[model samples]
Structure formats: C-alpha cells, structure tokens
Target: MSSYEEIASPADLHADCQAVSHRLQEAAVRATRPAPSIHFDERRREVPKRGIEISEAAQRLANALHLHLD
Candidate 1:
C-alpha cells in the first residue's frame, strides 16, 4: 500500500500515539536537567504540536467520512 494508506490506517494511528508519547516522556526527562541549546528546545516543543495537528486532521477526516460515507 501507499504511504498515505499506512499513515491513515488505524494501526499506524496507534503507533503514532505511542511515538508521540515516547517523545513527550523524553522531553520531560530532558527538561528536568539543565536547558539545552535554544534550537534544541524549539524543536522539542514542535514535536507535540505536530502530533496534535496530525490528530486533528485525522479527526476531521473521520468526521467528514462519518457524515458522508453512508
């Protein structure tokens, strides 16, 4: 299947959730220590935001399909 299919799959959605959770956990651990470089901290914050955008897109797609796929 195509990359889009893989990403849109329920299985992959679950994997994305796990991956984001791992990233957040790692960021929390890093935050406990001294602050990293400015660039590093900036990229770190972007990670969760990207995940939220993806999740919102998925939700919107699901809602659209639910309304029109019948």
Candidate 2:
C-alpha cells in the first residue's frame, strides 16, 4: 500500500484544511488590528539603598589585577 492509502479519507483532509484556513484567517485579523496601548505612571517610586561590602584583601587583589590589566 502507498502513503496515500495510509490517510483515513479525503473528508478528514478537507476538515484539517478548513481548520488551518480558519486559524490563518484569525491570525490575519489579529495582525491587522492595532496593538493595545500601554500606560506608564509619571511618578517615580523610591528605591531602598543597597551596598555590597568586600573584604580588604579582596579589594587589594582586585586593584592589583586591574593595575596589571592596564
């Protein structure tokens, strides 16, 4: 038997084609429609201060490495 015979029937293929066509139509409609507008508040929110403390030995090592690179 050939691959064509593997398919159930022409009716099923027609139904699948119809479903794909419907999805394509829906996608086209969505593509044509304008995107929704996004609104941003003008006011800025305060952020908490954060700091990272490194050991003195690490800082000296980092400085030496930076000087070597330069």
Candidate 3:
C-alpha cells in the first residue's frame, strides 16, 4: 500500500495551502466591502379604495359600538 507522504508530497500540500489562503483572503475582502444601498420612494403607497359600501345598519352598529367603547 502507498504511504500518506507518497500520496500527497510537500509541494502538493504547499500548493493546496496557498490556494486555501488565497480563497480566504478573497472571502475576507468581499466581507469587508459595503453592501449596495436600496432606496424607497418618499411618497406614501396609495391603498385602493374599497368599492363595496357599508349598509346603513352596519354604520349604525359601528357607531353604537364606538359610543359604547367611549
């Protein structure tokens, strides 16, 4: 059977270490960079007016409930 040293020589290990270090440096640089800014419109979003009108009975009931709560 082949030994561990034979499978991965010193040169191979050094190259692997260099590749890993380079990747880590790239990741660190990406992490340090600021994220892009997102802007929201200053105007308020207009909600669609409800098409259905409340019945007179519902309005009276709501008024009664409001008076009771007050």
Candidate 4:
C-alpha cells in the first residue's frame, strides 16, 4: 500500500507487511473466473404468466425434472 506505517520493530513490521502481501495475493487469485463459462440473457428471468402455453415437449421435460427433484 502507498499509505503505510513508520514503526520501530523491523522484524514484526516485515511479518505484518508479508501478511498483507499474502492476503492481497490470495484476493487476486480468488477474483478470477474459469475460462469456459456460460452467460445467459439476464433479462428473461421473470416468471411466466398463468396462461402461457408451454409446448408439450417443454411440459414433459419440466415435469420429468420436477418429479425427479421431489
């Protein structure tokens, strides 16, 4: 960090600085995603209306999934 300390104990100061550096390194590692990932049309997330006519194939698929999960 640009903003840091001016303390006495150099050994403890080195340990503290190493701890901070290690934390920053771990944070950098975590802030990444896998190469092959999927994204969707986020706008199409609303629940379907009551009378929306799902196709027979879609209905069968949904029912199969629902039955298995339950």
Candidate 5:
C-alpha cells in the first residue's frame, strides 16, 4: 500500500512520514551538489536543422544561471 494508506494506527503514521521526509531531504542534498563538468565540443558540429533560435525563457534562465549560451 501507499504511504498515506499504509498508516493503520495514529502512532505508526510517523514512520511513513519520516520515510518520506528523509527521501525528500536526500533528494534536496543531491540537487545542491555540483555535478561533473560535461564537455561537449560541438562548435563545429552541424545539425540537420536549417536554423536554430534561442527561446526568451531559455535566455532568461541562462542569464540567471550565469551561463553564456551564445
């Protein structure tokens, strides 16, 4: 059964709650850590597409992340 349904008694409910909380905490910690740099030398690589256009939202996100996707 799912976590919300597995709780048979009021006292045992905390165990499920703690499990979910711990999982969320672990996920948060993993997200905060820096990932290894992914090197992609696609400067000269050509795509099948005729042209590409950067979206306004993507530009904003790049600026916010201090990334230069030029």
Candidate 6:
C-alpha cells in the first residue's frame, strides 16, 4: 500500500471547518437584517391594495378580449 502525505490533521481540519461555518452563519444573519431606509410597515399595508389593483386590471383586460370567464 502507498502512504499518503499529511496536510492537516483531522482535528485541525475540523476546527477550521467550524470556524468558517460560524463566520458564514454570522454573515448570513447580518445580510438578512433589514435596511434602515426601507419602510417595511408601509409596504405591508400596501400589499392588499396592490393585489386588488392587479385583479381589476386582469378583469378589464379579459372583458376587452371578450373572454368568458365565469
């Protein structure tokens, strides 16, 4: 059997992987935190209105095209 060369020990490799994983987790959490300038409350309030507007537009288009949708 041929012998393999050593790069990093199993323990050392495990520690390095854990450190990298922790850093990635931290970065992901920071990225998802909302921006200061965005008005999330206002946007949430507008959701229903936007849905209604879209529905009205679709209905108007269907009427124009003479498509019978029950």
| Model 6 lDDT per residue over 1-70, tens place | 4365657889999999999999999999999998776766656554444433347677788888997443
Worst 10 residues of 4 by lDDT: 34-43
- Give lDDT tens digits, candidate 2, residues 1-70: 7867777688998999999999999999999998665555644468678987777787788888884321
Best by lDDT: 5
Q: What is the descending lDDT order?
A: 5, 3, 2, 6, 4, 1
lDDT of each: 0.73, 0.79, 0.80, 0.74, 0.83, 0.78
Clashes of 5: 0
Using TM-score as the measure, name the better of candidate 5 and candidate 6: 6
Return whichever of 2 and 3 wins on lDDT: 3
All candidates: TM-score = 0.38, 0.47, 0.49, 0.38, 0.42, 0.45
Better of 1 and 5 by TM-score: 5
lDDT of 2 at 46: 80
Query: Distance (Å) between predicted and true CA of 38, model 6?
Result: 6.7
Steric collisions counted per model: 0, 0, 0, 0, 0, 0
TM-score of 1: 0.38
Model 1, 1-70: lDDT tens digits are: 6656544778878999999999999999988998657775566554443332346667778788884321
| lDDT for 8 (candidate 3) | 80
* Candidate 6 lowest-lDDT run of ten: 45-54
lDDT of 5 at 34: 91
Candidate 5, residues 1-70, lDDT tens digits: the string is 6677654786667888899999999999999999865667734467677788999999999989999677
RMSD of each: 19.3, 9.2, 13.8, 15.1, 13.3, 9.6
Q: How do the candidates rank by TM-score, highest first? A: 3, 2, 6, 5, 1, 4
